[model samples]
Target: MESVRTTTTRPAAWLMLGIVLVALNLRPSMAAVGPLLSAIRSDIPLSFSLASLLTMLPVTAMGLAMFFGLGISRRLGERRTVLLSLLVIGLASLSRLFLDSAPPLIASAVLAGIGIALIQALMPALIKSHFPDHVALCMGLYVTSIMGGAALAASLAPLVLLHGGSWREGLALWSALALFAAMAWQMQGAGSSPVAAAKAGRESFFSNARAWWLALFFGLGTASYTCVLAWLAPYCMEQGFSEQHAGLVLGFLTAMEVVAGLAVPAIANRSRDRRGVLGGLLVLIIAGFCGLILSPHHLGLLWPCLLGLGIGGLFPMSLIVSLDHLDDPQRAGGLTAFVQGIGYLIAGLSPLLAGFIRDRSGSFEGAWWSLTAVMALMLLMVLRFDPKHYARHIR
Candidate 1:
């Protein structure tokens, strides 16, 4: 990897485009699964719990991969790491084209998850490093692109199936997007050398109670998201919606997420204390879950809209709150990575848990109720995040 030349005027624009493209590849592989889960199971014969692993396994891989993300970057270099990850993602998506049984399908999920994690684990610091003055803008774009990719996959996968493609074809279609992202990334990453990996473990916050709190907060917030991403389409189908409409619901939900991801942070930015905003987001989530449990078929769109805006806003806000704990970008990025790493591990099980509840209760209502309670718990937790204690907790 070579370094970018500051004197070159064209590099910045190209790099930003590359970052956006790379971010777009992160979620489609996993996101496409829920909308097509029933179809896949109809052919492949998986129980609800087993099918949940398609999402859970990859999420678990993402969590585990973060612990070793630095080692991969150190050995392969950041630029190559991103390219390699994109290639891995593309091949994993491509492999779904021939998947006959559940084993290989789950395996690809893990493989793609690992690939997504490698890129994600590197990107934050990369953005902070190269786009110093524009870190916020770049990060915003990167986060939005991730949700945007999920929206595309969710909305389009069913359309693909409707137009004579099998569920396998729908899953495999993301390979094309991955290919484009890889090509764009390679062009921008040319001559970009490997930078030194940040020393995140040096100032170890593993023992800090506050770090654990942040991790738990982020984890619960993420659990809500993973559960929905893995089950929303199927749940919609249960409520009597067709596959296309179910897909559209998830797609629209994620689109709302993209909007909130950008909008919520901008609004939150106006205040140093984020608790009020956090509480509002939690209320939206609780309301969304309640709507799903009580009135899914009647006011269906509103529930997803509420959930998406809440969870989407919560995702970035959790990281922002964590990042606020440290002054240094490297250290802050490290903490955010740590929170997400643990958070993913917690999150990976949520879809599986929801699946189990659905199996036992004969409906997804129990799971939604549980998530509502979690949101309520979060509302209580939000009160403790006083801005004045930021330094004391870390110190």
Candidate 2:
């Protein structure tokens, strides 16, 4: 392949916009649904377990789809895959507008899951390739957008339902955002050179331990994110709050995550090694859990803020670590897919297990217990990770 220069500032700006737009769409479909799951379940006359499954289905599909994303990204070109994914997500999200039965609703979930998985798994690699110098900033920006999207969707979906008439209209509103993202991506794609496109196909990234580590860390971190977004709203309502208030609280938590998610990792990256940063985040996570259990109603704002902060740090740190650990951009992409694939798999189960525990125990305490234990395990993994040397030896 002929050589090609790195992307220029004009193209980079467009890529950045595309990244933010794509990231924004990733979480809304998943997070928005949780805030309304109970209402949807009641309206459809389905079991609580079924409601939980609807939430779980997308996450599971996300993980499952990530398992093959590197190859898919290679085949389609990362830009094309992302653009296509956005289109699929938009269509799937649009499908909810016509849903008259449980099966179609579930199909929407699955379609959104697949689209999200493709984007999530490939985003790290895309960032590394397009913004190698500004990865830390880019990571922060992308994650903040993710939390912002979740917060907006969480609060707005129910409001839309109340104001716009039905749950279908509420859910379908996000599809417009997804469509906007798809358009942005297509615009960015027009600037790519033939050499860049060819090189993308030649680059391979799915066969190393570094890839596995990235995938694992991403998986673990996202598992926490998924758990929080999926169950927090329901937990709030279950604790005697009204649905509107519950949705607002969840929105607030997600908004707090946007701030932390943007700031924490950027701060952590200032250090030579990030183990200390990781350790600190784990401590905060532990504190967040304690807050959740002991002073939930009283502390309210503080509790979710702490959890959001912890999650924000964890998610972006994992992404930053993946980039830091990989020498090649393609390897970064491969590792991203691996980590997200596994991370999403783990994430997919959090809501389901939480729901099952809640159903059986008649309380949300079990969910907290599960989160605490996962946080502990994640702490160990982050502590053991030696990002500086790990990737070179991973082969």
Candidate 3:
């Protein structure tokens, strides 16, 4: 198999900047909706079950779309795929401007999800191929930009409502970011040939034990994240925080995530194995989930900080570990997509499950405890993620 060739004079700086810009658009289309859920529900007259579906459908789309990412990239090339993703995201986001009800809104969210799935599934491979010597650092920046977008949207969505703007406007505003990213990406010039395409025929991703483990690990971690993103604001609001304040709290959590997302990968890069760092972060998430369950209102600030720092670090580390499992960029891309595809499908259930738990229990305690259990599972799973085990799977 041929390796991905790179030009010695490739514009690394501009490429990194483009990656950051594209990454920044990945999460806002979904993250922004959570904080504004109440307002949207009030206007659209949606049930809790239906509202939960608003979050679930997109994530499900993301998960399902992952399976097709490789095929799409093969047909369109990576650069064109990304550009198409940005345009899809922009159009989907703008669709919300005219949408006033549930079906259309959900459709827009699903479209945005498809775009997000394609870009995210391909990015790890792009980083591995382009920044071979600095995969961890590049993944760190990419993940940080993703978290930063989530934070910005989560923080600002409620503010848009607080200023008397409609939910449609609040949701539509993020399209501008997508548009800007599209423009920046276009300026970066032509796409590279699909680097990971050749390896697709060598190994069946489903047959690899390590792939299954990584997918499960990724799914469990994402479930925790999805629950938090979908419910934390409403949970806080139930505890007497105003909508704006709850959004800010969720925003604060993602902001801490951005900080941890950038720092953890950089620190973990110094080590050959990341189990120790992964272990410590899982502990923090456990503590945070426990706090949120037991006394959410008492130490409100601390719980999210812990959650943010822990999960923030875990997100990139999970992807980085998967990328490190194989030397071939194409193989790594296939593995990463499989991980995200299965993981996100699992994660798509979280918001709905949390909503079910919330509706049944009349509180989010069950939801929080469920996440705590997931964190424990994540800790146990990471123990098996020794890099040596994955080294054997590399073709």
Candidate 4:
């Protein structure tokens, strides 16, 4: 395998565009379904437990698929792997158009999850290799696009249903976006590159204490995020908001995430260490969780905005912190894959558990309280994540 060069003599606008487009497709399939879930349940007659699986299955698949991403990238090359992932996303999303029952819908989610996992696992490396000089800027753009995609889908799904489309059509329309990304990626003509293999005698991240801490922090943070994504709109509807209005509130929350996703990284990048920043964000998350539990209906806009700001900052910062732990890009990448793999697996269970809580208690308050506890745990976890402590572990 040939090593891919990281430095380039000139800027590649096409490559950046392709990256943004691919990022845009990453969340719509999952996000859109959540807003329209009520309509879907009405059509398909699914129980709460099964309905929760709609989100859980894809997330769980993504978690599991992360372990395979590097191998797939090595075999197919990064460019081809990404292109194939896009094709899979497009086809899987298209399948939703005809899927009328829970089983097939869950199957489509699984397929989309595999594609998403591969692309997400591979993309940061692609960005680092192709846009070394502008890695932060490109990454901020990519992350913002992902949140923006979710916001757009959440905002649009309710409208799609209101305008005479079924839940199937609402979910399936995202395939067009995926197909567009596939075409755009192909036009870049990006060639494949060899993935760096792990050193022969290095200790596995699985056994490292700091690694698990980071993964736990990431998982807890994502649990809060996935829980809201899967349940917020339904919670709002139960509180007397219309489906379309609930969707808009959910959209607003994700839009705030887009804002923080772009801003927080740039702000954190200038600081010598992220401890203060991470601490402050966690405070905001705790406040948001409290607001939701105490008075969700009354403080509609405030709580979501606060939650979005905190989560948006936390997600990217966690990844950046992990990368900062190791100077070696390959080692950092490996730790990143490990963290996300475990983190996503843990995060995947959040919605399922939240749904069960909702079923048993007949309210989402318990779920929100559960998220608050998770965030509190995340706060404690970060105290142990001081970068100086991990200096000895650097390769």
The lDDT values for all models are 0.85, 0.77, 0.86, 0.81
Model 2, position 324: C-alpha lDDT score: 75
Alpha carbon deviation, residue 73, candidate 4 (Å): 0.3
Ranking according to lDDT, highest score first:
3, 1, 4, 2
**Residue pairs of candidate 2 with colliding backbone atoms:** 215-338, 215-339, 219-343
Candidate 3 global TM-score: 0.96
lDDT (Cα) of model 1: 0.85
Per-residue lDDT of model 2, residues 275-368, tens digit only: 8888788778778878888888887888888888888777888777766766666666666566677777777787777778888888878888
Q: 1-395 in candidate 3: lDDT tens per residue?
A: 22343536557888899999999998898888878988888889876667788778889999999888877877777778899999999999899989867899989989999999999878887788788899999999999999999999999999999998988888889989988998888887536664346455234688877788888898899888888988899888888889899999999999999999989999999986999999999999999999888888797899999999998999999898888888887778788999999999999999998898887889888888888988887887887878777777655
lDDT by residue for model 4 over 6-84, one digit each (tens)? 3353247777788889998988888987779889988898776788887888888888887778778777766788889
Q: All predictions: root-mean-square deviation over Cα?
A: 2.0, 2.7, 2.0, 2.0
Count of clashes in candidate 2:
3
Q: Candidate 2, residue 77: CA error in Å?
A: 2.6
Q: Which parts of model 2 have CA positions greater than 4 angstroms off? A: 1-5, 190-214
TM-score for all models, in order of appearance:
0.95, 0.91, 0.96, 0.95
Better of 1 and 2 by lDDT: 1
Candidate 3 overall Cα lDDT vs. reference? 0.86
Ten consecutive residues with minimal summed lDDT in candidate 1? 189-198
Candidates 1 and 3 compared by TM-score, better number = 3
Which candidate leads in lDDT?
3
